[model samples]
Target: MSDRIIQSNKEELYASCIKRKMEGWRLAQICAVTINDGFEMSYTFVKDSDMDTLRICLKEDEPISSITQIYPCAFLQENEAAELFGVHIENITMDYKHKLYRIEADTPFKAKEDA
Candidate 1:
């Protein structure tokens, strides 16, 4: 099937992720919430049009995908996941640089911190 992309609300995205996982879709990339206040999650997959590309926006909870079982290459994506949204991946090998918050760690978020 051809690849299809869609934007989903926070709750819808989480549900979609679960639904896709049940269908055995592997997690591709997790682009952090650069413009969505860390509430949006971007995911890519190798599936049919009905389940190809999905964008989920999560409000308070950070969702995680155990794609390591499906694709070993997901490690990098997992790292990026943490680096972008500050979502912790369970049992996944991670370090400082991979932490999303640390990406801006060098730069203070407040004027006082910068001072």
Candidate 2:
């Protein structure tokens, strides 16, 4: 395993996606922040013990990548996030298994209309 890291601004994040694809690295996790100006997204790369971690950040209304094409495990992470944080994950082929909660609405953070 080798270590690789790249830091990019909002406009350069697409290049980061291409780099992740070229390296065949999977996505370990994704975190985002909702601010008055915009949203900040951070995609964490799946790293091996010897491989260095890659963290890419950007502020976009909606951003996406196809790291799933290289690493299939990423779909689960993406799907869970989509349901939790309301981001759209493209190219997901299977049902999203919610390992975090027992039973919840499509949007876990959404307050039930009847509630």
Candidate 3:
């Protein structure tokens, strides 16, 4: 099935997620990329065998609202993103407290340019 991706602003993140969930979309994955001055987060959802992604850009220290309230399965992926990319995810149902990884350096996946 074809995949659809939509860019979303921070202000619309929660509402967008809620709308998707109400439409029977399941959270598939949450991915993050370290950019020059920030991080780009993608929330992928699946429905009817098709995939949809919601993309949002955030500054290095920006805090993102956790979607666990809408998709409980998002806890792990959101924690991983927080630990590896240093994107602060707020109100996580079960936050790993940024301890998802035991690496020497925090935010190990963050690009040097963004660090």
Give TM per candidate: 0.50, 0.52, 0.91
Better-scoring candidate (lDDT), 2 or 3: 3
Arrange candidates, best lDDT first. Answer: 3, 1, 2
The stretch of ten residues in a row with the least summed lDDT in candidate 2 is 52-61
Give lDDT tens digits, candidate 3, residues 1-115.
9798899877898998899899998898999999878999999999997998889999988888999999999999999998888888899999999877778898888876524
lDDT of 2 by residue, 13-107 (tens): 55665686677755666665443433445666754553434444333235556345656666666666656655544565553644444555665
Pairs that collide, model 2: 3-52
Q: At residue 87, what lDDT does model 1 achieve?
A: 55
lDDT of each: 0.56, 0.54, 0.89
Native-to-model Cα distance after best TM-score fit, residue 14 in candidate 3, in Å: 0.9
Clashing residue pair totals per candidate (backbone < 3 A): 2, 1, 0
Candidate 3, residue 72: how far the Cα is off, in Å: 0.8
Pairs clashing within candidate 1: 10-57, 83-100
TM-score, ranked from best to worst:
3, 2, 1
